[model samples]
Target chain A: MRKEVRVAGFGGQGVILAGVILAQASGAIEGREVAQTQSYGPEARGGAARCDVVISDKRILYPKVRQADLLLAMSQPALAKYAVDLDAAKGKVVIDSTLVNELPDGLPPVYRVPATKIAEEEFKNRIVANMVMLGALARVDDVVAYDSLKRAVAENVAPKFRDLNLAALDRGYQAVEGPGLRPAAGANDAPGAPASGGR
Target chain B: MSEDGRKVRIIQGNEASVEGAIAAGCRFFAGYPITPASEIAELMSRRLPPVGGTFLQMEDEIASINAVIGASWGGAKACTASSGPGISLMQEGVGYAAETETPCVVINVMRGGPATGQPTISSQQDIYQARYGGHGDYEIIALVPSSAQEAYDLTIKAFNLAEEFRVPVYLLSDEIVGHTRERVVMGGPIEVRERVAPPKEGYRPYAAGPDGLLPGMPAFNDGYRLLVEGQHHDERGIRAGDDVNKSAALVQRLNDKVRKNIDRITDVERVDLDDAEVAVVCFGSTARPALEAVQSAREKGVKAGALRLRVIWPFPEKVVAELAGRARTLIVPEMNIGKLVLEVRRSAGGRAEVISLPRLGGALHTPEEVEGAIMDAVKGGNAR
Candidate 1:
């Protein structure tokens, strides 16, 4: 199976790192063909940043993502910019409910996770929010094995933060189990409605 | 794999190039940092020390190229890398390396051109610059790689060719190929080329052997008296001082050393060209999309094929001419504004219809774009 994934957020959200870990999990640990590319403006931080990871069973002919099969948005601007490019009929969308308060109408199946809230409240660090999103992605999609992702996170993170990041990942994986966390009711559903009913 | 049994690893192209250089026995690196090419310098700084090699971040591109040449004469396999603007500053130094017959590698991770255009974007705009950037009539070998694996593999080939031919060789990469990450098989036993050393007894540095090529070099401070200069010199390394015949012969020999070995130096990856009616000639990152376009065209019964030029300089004229003779139409797509297509037209020699599909402004040609051009060429329509 060929899967094209895009992870987008501001520069400091560790969006590029999340993409790298995904690529490693699928390619190095799982022995699959993968290509990862990232782009950002001149600003070092606070500017929009995005990464594209293409995982395939066969040789990848084109490296860039023409239409993303999985879209992970960590900010309002990133979702507004890239959500339209997702494959509407079959694509899966994941968004951080803590930062992104709005969702477009008539979207594909969307999984909303309180990634930043879990990192900030449980781990006392908001920086591990990307790891939380990764965990949720693993739970939502069977693109890569959960064990492979755990190993990848261990290998990619620094020694000091490895334990905290892994904890964040586990919490993220469990976030999808709460009730009323499916796709929003309709296009006109209230903003921030998905996260209020869940812990 | 090496004897230690290290397997494949996913790495960026710039990192792969460094590994390739290290595998090729390159012991010295000097370069100034530039965007899209800076990763090469960063990795070299970290990796060279562990291997007991030397890495120097020179003050600028001018100093970097000169240092590379000096290290080459110091009996070390040396190289330097930069992007377009930095490469522009190193032109005089590159010319000096050519004149002195220094065996060194110069990598230009090409970007959008003319000035400091598009540092983060990729472009094939340096095709002319790689060939004619340095002044005077001289020849240099240039290799263009399409993937990160080739970026690793061809860098070793670049160094080997540089040492074997005793000339400056270029690995013409672009931002896309340098920055993209892919699976590159690491840890292989590579054949490292040894620099030819001159006989200790009465060696002349500039003397050409019976084949009219440069002889083995005597290392500096190796108890052999050697005078290296950029001026016109004779077999005994003495200044010829505007002696028209001697200077003309020296210049001719310098050019002939590479031109005579053109057949051995040229390499092209031809795909699906057995009965192609339309052919696309491309190189570097652009070849990726061209390959897909050719496959798509074949599916549509267009009989489309592709000839990817692995060696851009020394211009694979013979292969191109043969392909042109067999195919009715030739489409040349590049990331620049029709620089290499002119060479393709000249090589085609009116044997076929040569079309230039030039895409500029820091964007690559999609497979759809190339496929549309191929279809247009097959219909004998003038399409840009």
Candidate 2:
């Protein structure tokens, strides 16, 4: 089974960076085969940026994710744009409670987290919202160990921002790692274990 | 044979290529996916992470090649793979690596194209592009693998050739070879081709010595102030030529390293061509049919042989010229209208009658067609 996820939001919302951190954790740290692709043109401003990450043991046939198992939409536009591609029966959707005003109809089990509110109220850094989103993705997918994801964030972020990123990740983890959250079906599995290495 | 390692298995051409890159000690990959070549990016994305390496799918083909360049300097063996349209976008990056003498591998899985011609159809139209698409007067090593097994073996060779010469190597394949389903013998850990990392001190990124070619480059963050770009530059990698003589000399030297070392880079599998009166020259998938054609001709006492060009670039002029001396006729069969045939014509030196047998699209030339061409060439009177 492959864990295919997409993180989408405005350029500065750290969607691409969030995807990178998860990819590194699942792919590099966990020793799974991982493919991460991002979409961006010359307009690096407020344009929408989407990153696709596919983690599988067998060789991934296509890097472009046609159907996403997990979708993290940090804004309304992201939710509206990618909601149709989500497999409602088998997928999971996480939205930022602050930016997303209403959940789309016929969506997967939507988990709402006040990512921006947490980043503003506690972390005091807007960029840290991605960290919260990452934590939420971990809670929803459990594709990689929460500790492994934290380690990936610590190793990937610039030295100056590493401390805040790790703190934000832990805070996000603490918020959703409890009993009320939906259990991940393929949870606690190593990323790209040998048995699943090649297709 | 298996203990000697690098055996084969039943694998797709793209998977074979990924395994081959790893066997060649390629630890970094940065690429964007396009059809017919997406499997390469997919495989690298997963494989690089486990070995403490990095796999990045950049924003586009341009960024993909650029990031590969960045990672190469970051002291990682780097590579990228793409189909026709994406490769067209990567020409600038290819020129950049050639100018900087940055060692990396770029795999171009050829598909029918002038502009998005056919993403999934096989064609060898990129032969000239592989040699001339990059912007400057530079030479590159391009290897063409005919089968999945060769795809695996040649990717390793591509990395070795790239590092040994300090230039970008091209594992040039068509959609047929890229997506072909064949039993690839993939066995024990093969001997990987590792780059000769530069010394700690006295490392100039482009210090071409009396031999007049750049040396093995040092990595970035390695204390060496490495200067790199896509300009006609001196040994210091600083843009040094606005005049004809300097630019001409630089181009000559860049061309010389591989042009001079053809025996090493030009891997031609000559099957019974030693004393044949007719020669069939081909590369990639076409060569398989061409080989059968040659065998059938010999059975009919036509004295025909086949030369499969495993390495497409560097042209193998000397070998072709030598083989031309012994053969009375050289039949050049390729998938494209006529690309590599021109190279063969020039190298055959008018000693042998050079004939071109062309095809296009997903229509593969059958062994009977190639046999007919060989027979027709043999029957013709232009035996110079």
Candidate 3:
């Protein structure tokens, strides 16, 4: 099966790092094929930056996300800009609700995790918001195995931030169960969040 | 790491190149940082030093290429990396390397441009520039990697070819392939070819042996009197600008050395092309989407296939002609306006209808987009 995940936020939110961890979890730990690409050129500071991770049992043909199965929108503008291309019925969006004041209409199931709030409150650092969202993504969708993500975090993160990153991933993973994973890979209507139709 | 719990590493495309270069005994790296390609220089800075290699961040791209050439002459496997704008600046140095028969590798992590067009975006626009960038008639090996693993494998190939052929070799990649992260399996016991040293007796710096390659390149201060002149010179490395026969022979041999070995130097991947009436010809990161499109078209019962160029330069003419002979239509897709498509047209030779699907300063061709082009090619039904 092919799964494409896109993590988007402003420049300094560790969006790219989060995608790398997801890729490492799937590719390096689980031994699957993964390709990660990002919006890395001349993106202005504070602009909407994004990284795309394509995970597959077979070789990933196209590297970039064609239709994102999961969208981790850490900023309000990121959601506004990238939500249009999210898989309408099957896709899932995990947003940092503390920063996102509102949600666009007609998106797939959105799990509002308030990643920034949790990162600041529990970890004492707001920069780990991307990791929090990734953790929530694991619990909310099971795109990657939760244990592998923890392992990936341990292996990929900097020495200074490794402990905090693991804790942040665990906190997000344990707090919520991916309503989509309970049954099968196909994401269904779960009890955790409402499926938005209109504003 | 492999299924047996071997070392399966997740690395970016640029990082893979560094690992490959290190594996191939490349100990010298000189470059200037450029967007989308800076990571290569950054990683090389950390990578080369630990391997007992040297890393030099020169003042500019020209100095970077020149330094690489100098290092190569100093008897170290050397390379440099840059994007389009910076690579354009290295044209004179590249020519000098070609003229001097310097063995070095230059990685062009291509971006959009005639100038510094799109430092943040990706393009295959430099395809022609790499082959014919300098002022003289010369040929250089250009390998275009479609994935991160290929990036690693081809980089080692680039260094090996540079040393064996005594010509500057290029790994023509784009920002997408350069910056994308993927799994690269490190192979066991990488084979490396070092430049052959000459015998003590009767060694001329610019003279070709019976094998059509220079006898040998002596390291600087290696007990050999080497002039290292870039001007048209005789076998003794002395300027022979006034000697027509010597100048002609020297230049011809430089081009002939690579041309004669084209069969051994070229590599390509063919997918579902057997008995297909329509085929998509592509390279670099664009190849993946084109393959998907061709596969999807086959599901819909269209006789379509894909050909991906692993080695870009040497043109791979025989394969293109063979594909053109069977397939009635050839679709050439590139991230540039029209570079590889032009070569495809030339090689197709009106045997098949050649179509160019060009994109610029932007994203890769989506499978859907390439599928649409394939469908159109099939519908057009232009026969040979």
Candidate 4:
């Protein structure tokens, strides 16, 4: 089986790094075929940025993601831009509730997690918001094992920030089982509605 | 393989090229910073010095290519990389390397262009430029890699070919392949070809041996007084610009060296072409979608296949003609406005209907688009 994941946010949110980590988890740690590609623009930070990761049991033919199976939007602009590209019927949408305050109607099972809020309130650093979203993604989708992601996070992040990032990942993973935080099954609610239950 | 057994890692194409260069004994890298290809220079800068090699960041692409040529003459495997604008600037140097018979590698991680078009977007627009970018009549070997693994493998092959043929070789990668990260399996240590040195008695630098190719070159500082110049030179490395016969012979030898060994130099990968009614001809990153389209078309009972040109230059004419003889139609898809397709048509010789599917605007052709073209080719059914 082949799975395509799109991670999008403004630059400096570690969107590209998150995509790389996902690719490493599947490709290097789990010994699967993976391809990750990102868009580079003139703006270094605070501009629109996105990355696509393709994980496959066999070799990947087309590396680019035509229709993403999993869409992780960390910003409202990214959500507005890439939401239409997701598989509307079967694709899963994961968004950061703190930043993306709006959601388009008629999306596959949407999972909302206040990634940046948890990163700032608990870890006192908002840069690990993408890691939080990744953690939540692992819980919603069992395509990639949790151990593989943890190992990938440890291997990819900077040596100095490795500990805090690991903590952020754990917190994000635990947040999936937190009170009222679950994968909403086909429920189209307001933009910042709390998570319902796991898919 | 990381100094151990078989190793696997996730790396981008640019990074893979660096690893491949290192494996191929490329110790000298000189390049100016350019987007899409900058990561190569960055990795080289960080890696070369620690491996007892030299990395120089030249002021411009001209200086970079010249420096690479100089390093090659100094008896070191050398390379330089850039995108389209920088590659255009280095055309003069590339021509000089070709004429002077310098063995060096030029990596063109191609981006969109007529000029400074798009820095980060990918394009195979440099297909024509790579083959005929230099002034005058000359042939250079160019390889197109589709994935990170091929990027690594083909780079080693590029360096080997550069040394073997004594010509400036090119790895024509696009931004998509250059920047895309994928899983790459590292092979065992590659066998690097050592440049042969001439005997002490009666050594002529530019003279062709019995095989009609220049003799192995001695390094500049290796007790051999060498005169390396862009102008036409005689067998003894002296200026022969006034001697028309000498000039003609020198140029012919340079061209003949590669042309004679075309079959050995050309590399291509064919897929599902046995009973194919339609064939998709493509190269580089574009091959990814083309292969997918071919498979999808086959599922729908269209006898479609694909021929991916790993070695873009030397044209692989015989293979193209053979495929044309078998398939009823040939579909050439490229990111450019119809560069390689023209070559396909020329080689096809009207034996098969050649169709061009051109995509510009810095976007790759999706499989759906290529499938549509394949379906149209099958429906047209106008094969002679």
Candidate 5:
């Protein structure tokens, strides 16, 4: 299956890092062709940062993802920016519930999780909010294996924050969901069958 | 797939140039960061030190070229790289290298520019700058590589040409050739060219032979006291500006050496021109896409062909003139605002209808765009 995802937020929110992890995990673990590209202007302060990752069994023609299958928004600005362009045919919108007051309705399958509060309050670090979001993404849609993502994170995260980010990922995977939360399409009965280490 | 017993891997053009430079025995590099060209510097920094070579990120482009020249004089095959604006800052130093007869490679990954025009934008605007940007009437050897393979292959050639002729060689690349990712083969053992040593017994650094050129030069402490400078000099490298005869002789020899050896540096790739009525003349980054367009046009029975120029400086005038003689119409497309198209029109001898398709800033004209221009040329347009 083809998966094209865009992770976007403020410049320092680790959204780009999340997209890179997803691309790396998909390529190295699933053995799929992946293209990860980020676009940002010169300014470092409060600028919009977006990274697009496209995973496919076939060759990726263009590096940029025009219509994203999944839009993971970490801030209100990110949601406002990418909500219109999400492919509703196969897209899922995941938002940070704490930062977002009202979720934009009539989108693809919506999952609102308190990503920032979970990372900062439960995991005791705000920087791993993107990792928490990635964990929630793995639980919602088995697009990438959680163990494969953890290996990807361990391989890519800066040495000082590796352990904290792993903990953040675990906390996110175990979070609560409302009644009758349907798993993503094509999810396997075998636990984390898409990912490695049987997690 | 294996061709010539080598594996192909996807790599960017800038990385291909870096690998090419490494394969060409370039052991010393000094450069500053510039968009569309930074990957060359970055890869050099990573790859050079492990192989007992050196790479330095200089403070600016001037310092970068200066350091490379210093490294070249220290008996190392050295190189520096930059984009258009940075290249402009290095012209004075580049002219100094020319006057001193230093052998070094300078890679200019051309970008859109007037003054910081657009940092991320791509253009082939550095053609004039590469040939005539430096002060005076000195001839520079410039190689234009059209693809990732050429970016790797011509770099070794660039070094050999520079050392053999005692001149600075510029690898003129643009954004398309710099950033495009394609298949490149590496790890092939290259046939290296060693520099020719000067004759013993009172060797003169600037002495003109019967052919009006300086012969091979030996390094310092090689049993000869070689005096080199940026000024007009006599046989022994002493400043000879006061004497008009010596200055004229020095300048004439410098020009003749390159002018006499144009055949050694001239290279061109021709495709489907035997029965063509219209031709597309282009160089550097525009050549590949234009050639693709020409092939598509030919399949549609438009009788179009392409001439991809490999040598920008010394301007492959003979081949261009020859190709122009055969075709009824010639269209020249460039990324800059009509820099090389003018040269094509001037050199084609007005035998063919020369058309200029110029695009400014970073945007590259797609193959369909060139196809439209080819169709226009097929419609009996007047010569420019």
Candidate 6:
């Protein structure tokens, strides 16, 4: 199967890092083929930045997202710019509700995850907002499992911030759907572990 | 996999090239960093020391290229990398390295042309610059990688080819391949050739044997008087440019050595070409879309195939010639304005219709865009 995802936001929002984490999880942890490419305007920060990822069980011919199956817009401008061209009815659009408060009318299925606000309030660290957004994405997108995403986050971030990133991911993931994917025990369950300890 | 276990990770093309260089026994790196290619130098700065290699960030591209030559002479497999402008600055050093027969690697992560055109973008504009950049009539090997995995594998091949041929091998990459991150298996059995060590009695640095390869490298501290003369040198590395006969022969020998071994240096990939009516010849990141377009065209009942060039240097003329013989039309899609297409047209030589599908600015030709060209070629739309 083939899946393409585009993540866009302002610079320093870690849009590229989120895409990298997603791709690494799909490719390294899950043993799939993946490619992650990014683009940014001419500015160190506060400019438009985006990363495109393509994941496939087979070799990915066209690396870039020809048309995004999913668009994770972390800002208002990103949503406004991307949502228009999207296949509204078919594609999934997840916006960070904290920054992107007003979504344009005549939209498809839109899931709201206030990643930044949750990062600031619950986690007391705004840096992990991207992780929160990724968590929410894993919940909505059934292509990749949450366990794989968590493992990728651990590999990407430094050791000091690994636990924080993983926690933010878990919160964002459960934020969209309470036990949306597997059972609640699956979160802490090790891979290939026998399904035991049922009440 | 080396002594250690297998290592599979997501790495950028530049970072992968660094890993390949280390695996291929490249111990010296001297470069002036530029956009899209900066990660190579940054990784080298950190990765080289631990592996018993030296990383020197030179003042400029010219100095960086010169330092690479010096390091090679000092018995280190060395390399330097840059974008278009830095490569332009190192043109003189390139000719010098070719004339002196120094075994080194110079990676050109090509960007938009003529100057520092587009640092953060991708362009294959340096096809001519890589093959015929220097003033001298010499042939250097160039490997063009379309993906991060090839970027790693080809870099190791570039160093091996440089050592075996005793010439400056160019890893001609671009921003897309350099910056894009992909799955690259880092540890495996890699083939690395050792530098030839000649007899100490009578060492001729500029002499080629029956295999058209110059004698073993005369490392500076290896107890041999070393003289590396850039301007037309004789067998003993003496200043023989004044000797018209010897100078001309030396220059011709430099060209002949690489040309004679072109068969081994050329690397190309053919997909579904046995019954192809139209062939799409592509390299670099452009090959990705070209391959997709070929398959998409086949779905549309067009007999199309794709030939992806792994090693862009030595022109891969033989394979292209055979492809031209089979395919009725040949389409060349590239980021630049019809550079490699010229070679294709010449090699095709009326055997097949050659078309140029060029994309400018920062964007690459989409698979749909390339398929349109394939359809056009099959319908005899852009036959030239």
Which numbered prediction scores highest in TM-score against the true structure?
Answer: 4
Ranking by DockQ: 4, 3, 6, 1, 5, 2
Q: Please give the ranking of all candidate structures by TM-score, highest first, separated by commas.
A: 4, 3, 6, 1, 5, 2
Error of 4 at A188 (Å): 27
* Candidates ranked, most accurate by lDDT first: 4, 1, 6, 3, 2, 5
Off by over 4 Å in 2: A1-199, B1-7, B187-189, B242-246, B381-384
Each model's DockQ?
0.60, 0.02, 0.73, 0.78, 0.11, 0.64
TM-score of each: 0.93, 0.64, 0.94, 0.95, 0.75, 0.94
lDDT of 6 by residue, B1-384 (tens): 436655887889999999999999999999988887999999999999998899999999999999999999999999999999999999899999998889999998988876757778889999899888889698899999999999999999999999988999999999999988998888667789888778888777776898778767879998987898887778889998799999888878788888888888888898989899989999999999999999888887788999999988888888888888989989999999888999998888889889999888969889999998888777674454
Model 4 chain A poorest ten-residue lDDT run:
A183-192
User: What is residue A70's positional error in candidate 4, in angstroms?
Assistant: 0.8
Model 4 C-alpha lDDT per residue in residues B112-181, reported as the tens digit of each score? 9989899889999998898899899898999999999999999999998998888999999999999999
Model 3 regions lying over 4 Å from their true place: A41-44, A174-199, B1-6, B382-384
Q: Which stretches of candidate 5 lie over 4 Å from their true place?
A: A1-40, A44-199, B1-7, B208-213, B381-384
DockQ of 5: 0.11
Model 2 chain B weakest 10-residue run by lDDT: B1-10
Badly placed stretches (over 4 Å) of model 1 are: A177-199, B1-6, B381-384
Better TM-score candidate (2, 6)? 6
Clashing residue pairs found in predicted model 4: A182-A197, A183-A197
Model 5: per-residue lDDT, tens digit, B134-203? 9897888898877666788888889988888778899998766776544466765676677678788877
lDDT of each candidate versus the true structure: 0.87, 0.80, 0.87, 0.89, 0.79, 0.87
Candidate No. with top DockQ: 4
TM-score of chain A of each: 0.88, 0.87, 0.86, 0.88, 0.86, 0.87
